[model samples]
Target chain A: MRTSFKPLAAGVGGVAAALLLWQAASGARAAGGSLPSVGSVATDLGALAGSPDFWSALAQTVGIALLGLAASGLGGIVVGILVGSFEPVRYATRAALEFLKPIPPIVILPLVVLILGPTGQMSWFLVFLGCLLPIVMQTVDGVHSTDPVARDTARSYGMKPVEILVRIVLPSAMPYIGTAMRVSAPAALIITVVAGLLGGGPGLGQSLYLAQAGGDYPTLYALVIVLGILGLLFQLGTRVAERRLLHWHESYREVAH
Target chain B: MDKLMNKRPVLWLLGIGTPALLLAAWWLASAGSTDTFFPPLADIVDRFRALWLFDHFGSDVLVSLRNLVLGYAIAALAAVAVGFVTALAAPVRWAVDPLIHFLRGIPPVALVPIFISLMGFGPEMRVASIALAAFFPTFIATVDGLRAVDRGLLDVAQVYRLSRRDRVVAVLLPAASPQIFSGLQVSLQTAFVVMIASEMLGPSRGIGAMTLLAQQSFMISDMWSGILLLGVIGFAANFLFDLVRRKVLAWYIGSRRLARAS
Candidate 1:
């Protein structure tokens, strides 16, 4: 207990020191005085916390991200299973998936923004695209990696194909799906933010851009802090959710021991 | 069963056929297009040929590439340097761990506004944003890689009375290179995305800026062509990075292959 407490105390001290350093730097005119003092930014953040507009913008961003992820999660798992179960389809799509996987979502940002007119729809579509391929790929890998021996044994036992799929394949693939979702969640949020920042779409990103344009440095700085904290929450949320969902898996079981 | 997939000819056919078929279908479908937003692929190709063949190539494409490469290089070097010190010093690690994790969570694109606020709309702003955004992944990877180095190997170096520089160069770096390279790949991707975001938000000079401008002005074909160029560049950059990673890590891969075989 004492040993663990030391690290926690050190972490808190570190954060305090960083705040102090930022305050000093701002006073010293770091980056030619554009940097806002930490105190002023925090005060502005407090003000923003009470604004209805700020809450709505935050909702828009979070809504786009969650809806995008949920859609992609459902679509990817279904498609991945269908493709992975069939040899021909898997081979046929492998090359195309590889080619498309590395292309960043930003490549299509302009086209979507143009078509959708910088709406929440545009942000949602971009986030969906950004998160879809990875989930599909991971799910496919998970399905493909199911133990052949278990499958063969099930076949010899005269188990129905549907039964085997439900009893064996899905359980085996759960960990992979969990991991893919964990990675995709943050990516979904980031894409939504980019849609706002660059495409004039609706979200906190647009708010940040407006503040910067208005020379509301305090508000801009405050919004950035909000975004940073929001991002941290998304990451932590997914990680905890993954662990909880995969508690029955061997990796977590070993940790329990 | 899966043998058909292993044949070189089948692999090549699928690889070449899929993209060609998709493009052919798109071309046919969009032909005689009346929709203002959806231009025919033929017109897009023509615009792509004119605008990107050499016209805006120097002005936009090269500028974006220069910024990306320079920023990525700066980030990779700085992260590795800082990572070494942080990994070696317990006090530094304790102080920085929570802060690092928090900063890493902030999406790279979100940093652009802060940078724009500081530096305004300039080339320096773009590069600075790209570099800072690209730094975290490599820094975390480097620290992990260095810390995970085998204690036995360090002991061996100590017994051999090796100089500190030699110990790091010979014993530490090669062992850590694989993880570092993976982090570099992520950093490059982050840098590329941030590069596009910064340009789109800015002084309007690079490929991204031009692309956004063309779309806003309703030059639909030109916009399509810009999107096409970006896709191609993104694909090519990844392919090139993979080639480099493969060449650099050939020895590590060979050993792993041997271990698996045994």
Candidate 2:
């Protein structure tokens, strides 16, 4: 429960030690191959920061991820609410959803490429499909977890289905929605990169794949570092949003901090 | 009459209707397009039958599944062992947490080229890639499961003077099973995804490679068939996991049912 400095220090130390080992291994490999030293990778990382291509790719990656996430978030919430509310709908749809949900959308890249022609459009489609099911399922679970009393009361008050959904159901499901967003955000990024790698789009993923193919260790390492940073940023942002939005929820309450 | 009116068929219709409608719309929209991109639904189905089922596309599916299972099993075993040791020791947990987080944050796909360069174009490299993909989720889940064990339960064990091994096996393992199972579900999904991606990039035998080959040959329908097969496999894995979960965690399911009834 406690986030003490000692544990933090220990965790950092562990990471450093792992990196040290990696560096040593790379050094040994350097004798026979083009292994970039840690310092050289750091320099490449700095150079990447200033490069127009890197910035463009970063922009493209972030743009696709955000767009796909937005689409999924909106579509998922709507479909999830519909599924959660109507029992007949839920019963009828459960099997189909189960059948469809687990299928990795990444496998359809070639199909998407065939249809959409390996464009940014295909990239967006891939990322959107990758993140959709999780977000939708989480939203449905959230909606289902809402207080039975509140739902009944709204029904008794002659609240229209749409009204109850927007006012009563959605508000209650915010926590779950937030959690879904947090989970899906990383997924969106990863899928976007994968799309780029496979479809030859201008993103961090494509750059990394190209660098790897070109055997540019320094650039590959640099790109990997950047990807890690982006992931960290997403996690931190999600935590901040979750705390601010769901402060009243029991799950978000600080433990006498 | 009212009871008959509320039959399961009505429920089934409700669920299938929307997706069916969607598919119909898709078929209609793409009906006129003779382009390779928008192959009609009928064409895809025909292709699916010819390429995947009737023509015996078993080798590709088997290869991918074999890699997925072997890699996931290895990763699950190793991660569970390492995660348990770390969980049992606060020092180890603290020491390794950051490293785990760092590695986990880096998407497994990013490591494909590295694995290829290191291990070359072989099953070993594919297995390693899948293992890397599976390891983090399982490790994190195991740690979470261990941490989430009720302290009061541990206290009870201590009062009963249970051996450390007994405490872990009897008390901790059952309590952690749900979380561990969730991790397994996630790891399995991840392994399959990574398997396809790795094969697409490097190898020549799995579903991913088949998709790539179909693309290169301009066999759009064959590519669609491969994609459809992958989807079916993914769905089957998830459905099977759910069935296993129901059986293994019957107590959990029973409790839920009781709560709902009350």
Candidate 3:
């Protein structure tokens, strides 16, 4: 217990030192003299904590991200499985997918906004596109990772293909799906913020942009702190989810230590 | 991945069939496009030919490439250097981990306004933002790669009394190349996205700026051309990256192939 406390104390000290360094760099005598102070930023955050608009913007971003995950997650898995299991479909789609996959998701944001207008739904659509590729690729990898011996044994027993897929295949693929979701969830949030900032869509990013435009440096800095906290929370949440969801997998077994 | 195993000559033609069909379908669908927003593909092609090929050599393309290549190259070198130090030194890792996470979580777009305020609407702002956006992924990947290197090999290096530089270059880097390269690929993707985003946010220059400008000016065909130009550049960049990755990882690939054969 005493030894572990040393590292924890060191971590706290490290973080404190970082804060001090930032404050020094952003202080009055700093090069530009335009940087936001840590104290003022914290005070502004305290003030904004009482505002409903702040909460709503936060909610809008998180809501769009969650919805985007839902939109892409299951369908992506099903499509990935289909593509992985089949030959012709995979081959035919390969060239097109390769061409489209490299095009950054932001490139299509304007196209979507132009077609759909700057709605929450539009933001969700953009997030969906942003997340689809990684999830699909990972899911396909998961499906392919299934043990052939297990599959052959199930086949020898004359198990129905549907039953085999549901029972054996799905369980095997769970670890990969968990990993994919972990990756996709963060991407969805980033895309949500991008949509909000650029497409005039609903989210914390919109609020962030507004604060910048309004010259509310304190507010701008505060919102970014809030975003950084939210990102950290999402990361922690996904990690816990991954641990619980993939407890049976070998990867999880290795991670447990 | 399964699609690549069977390398029949005729399969290549079959793979091309879908993209050709899709392009044809797009052309047919937009043949007489009355909508000002969705211009005909032919009109877009004409604009592309005029603005990019026949006109001023697309200087914006050069500007954008300069930003991307310069930013990405600097990021790759700096990340690997920093990652080596952080992974090897426990005190530094403990000291810097929280700071890294805090900075990394702030999305690249969020930094644009701040950078513009600091550096003004100039190439410096664009490059700084792009470099920053490209840095963290490669840094994290390199650290992970370094950490995953075999301690046995490291011990062997120490036992041999190898110089510190020799230890890293000969022992650590090769072991970490695969993961680091994967990180580089992700960094390039992030850089491309940030490059376009930074351009869009700015006083206008690159393909991204051009697209935004054309859209605002009601030059719909020009907007399509700009988007297409971005797509073409992105596709080419990815192809080149893959080629480089293949060359760099050839030894790793060969070993894996041998393992499979046996």
TM-score of B-chain for each predicted structure, in order: 0.94, 0.89, 0.92
DockQ preference between candidates 1 and 3, better one: 1
Instruction: Please report how far candidate 3 places residue A18 from its true position, in Å.
Output: 2.9
What is candidate 3's lDDT per residue for A96-160, written digit by digit as tens? 87888888778877677777788998999998888888777777777787899999999999999
Worst 10 residues of 2 chain B by lDDT: B51-60
- Fraction of the reference Cα-Cα interface contacts (below 8 Å) that each candidate reproduces: 0.64, 0.61, 0.45
TM-score pick, better of 2 and 3: 3
TM-score of 1: 0.95
TM, every model: 0.95, 0.90, 0.93
Model 1 stretches with alpha carbons more than 4 Å out: A1-13, A255-257, B1-12
Name the docking class for model 3.
medium
lDDT of 2 by residue, B191-239 (tens): 8888988888854688788877888789877787778788888888878
Tell me the tens digit of each residue's lDDT in model 3 across B94-147. Answer: 778877888777776777767766676788888998888899989999999998
Better candidate number, 1 or 2, judged by lDDT: 1
Candidate maximizing lDDT: 1
In terms of lDDT, which candidate is stronger, 1 or 3? 1
- Lowest lDDT block of 10, candidate 3 chain A: A27-36
- Model 3: fnat (fraction of native contacts): 0.45
